[model samples]
Structures are given as C-alpha cells and as structure tokens.
Target: MFQRPGKNEYLESQERYVSLVPAEGDLLTILKEQTAEMHSLLGGLTEEQGNYRYAPEKWSIKGVIGHLTDNDRIMSYRMLCFARGEQAPLPGYDENDYAAAGEFDRFTLKEMVEHYGIVRQSTLALMASFKEDAWTGRENSMTRK
Candidate 1:
C-alpha cells in the first residue's frame, strides 16, 4: 500500500483536499467505493435536475460530471507519465473552459454518469498496475507554468 503523500507532495492550496482522507485509508478501496456512490447518486437524477444550474454562471449537474471526468483523465495521464519516469512538464487546464467546451448538456444524465464511472475505472486500473515503488519512489514530476 502507498503511504499518504507528504505535505510537499502537493501544493499548499490542496491541503484541504488531501487532509480529507485519513493517513491509513486504502486509496484504491476508497476510490472504488466512491465510484459506486457517485454512480447511484448521479444516476438517479431526473433530466430536468441534471440541466438545472443554480446560478447564471455555474455549471449544471451534467457539466459538473463532465468537468470531473475531464479532470480524472488528465490526472491519470499525469500519473501514467510520472510512474514511467517521464521528465516533461505537464500543462495546466481551465476547468470552466473545459466544461463549456465539453457541451455535456447535449448528453443524457445517465450517459454522463456512465462516462464518469468508466473514467474512474480507467484511473483505478492504471493505478493498480503500478508497483509500490511507482507510488512512493518517484519525485513529483508534474509541473505547471
């Protein structure tokens, strides 16, 4: 099992997120559990509810899922590169821009939820393939300008 990341592993701004998980928690199990929880929660929403944005500028349910899916894909790709010892810098992304361009509003809520589940599974599979060293031996290779 991988040890929880040190404070230096991630940015200071991300401490809140990192702290939410217990140091002893099993990362793979937690991720698997969350996938089922999110699928059930999001899959049960009605079409109208999925399209309802609370504010003029906020993302709707589908948009949020799309953003999450995109985020997972990017994160997993970075993990893949780093685990393999890549040295290139990774690029930053704008979530709002990605959400807007995704046009998730066009797909049914169920589709978006399913897609999210698939992406989550892909991430899990990639992580599972890594040996313990891949999780702890590599210095963080990800960087943004």
Candidate 2:
C-alpha cells in the first residue's frame, strides 16, 4: 500500500519531481497504471516519427523515450541500493551521454517502447519483493556540485 513519503524521505532537490508522484496508491498500482498509460500514449509512433526532432540539436522522439528508459534503470538501481541498506554513496549518471550512446534513432519507435515495457516489468517485480522495512528504508543523501 502507498504511504506518502514524509518530507525527509527524499532530498530537497528532488522535491519538485517526487511531489508529482501520486500519494494515494501503492507504488505498484501507480507504476502499473502509468506504464499502461505511457504505452498507450507512445504506442502509435512510427520509426519515421520517432526520428523527428522538434528542433535542430534536440533529441529525437526515440532518444527522449530511450532517456526515460535510462532514467528508470538508474532510479530503480538507487531504490534497490536504498532498500538493501547499502551505505556506500551512489554516483549519478549523465542521461545525455546514455541517450547518445544508446543510438535510439537506429531503432523503430515500437522497439523503444517495447524496451521500456520490459524494464518496467522487471522494476515492478523488484518493488513487489520489498518488505515493509524496505519500503520505509532511507539512505544518506549525497550531493554533487
């Protein structure tokens, strides 16, 4: 079941984004519903459309989707570390670098969406295995300049 995270549960820098999360339902419930909604939203884009960028130097649609996948992986890893009570500081990743290296424009939009779905399923499973203590787990906040 979802318990809204307390003010101290996450770092202040992330408050804006974390605050956007739904506070009324379990994590899995939100994940499941959002995943379905995301799939529906992006499912119709074709490879040609995915390659379209709104402006020069901007990320293509596929690149944007790929970055979302990368974010999911990175955040999930952080959650796993916190859940397992890992005391070591976790380093951050550059989403732009990951997106560039992913070469998402090489694939069809369908492939990118499919990849997200699979990763999300794995995330759901990992989250489902958490114990109550794990659910409430916290980690030391490490900041980078």
Backbone clashes, candidate 2: 0
lDDT of 1 by residue, 1-145 (tens): 4456777677777789778876877789988998999988887889999999999889999999999999999989988887888777777898889998999999999899989998999999998999888877646433321
Give a tens-digit lDDT track for model 2, residues 1-145. Answer: 3866767666687789778888778879898999999999888766788889999878999899899898888878887887787777788788788888999888889989999999999888888988877775444232212
Model 1 clash tally? 0
Clashes of each: 0, 0
Best by TM-score: 1
Q: Which ten residues in a row have the lowest lDDT in candidate 1?
A: 136-145
Off by over 4 Å in 1: 141-145
Q: lDDT of each model, Cα atoms only?
A: 0.85, 0.81
Model 1 alpha-carbon miss at residue 104, Å: 0.8
Which residue pairs clash within candidate 1?
Answer: none
What is the Å distance of residue 65 in model 1 from its true position? Answer: 0.5
By summed lDDT, the worst window of 10 consecutive residues in model 2 runs over 136-145
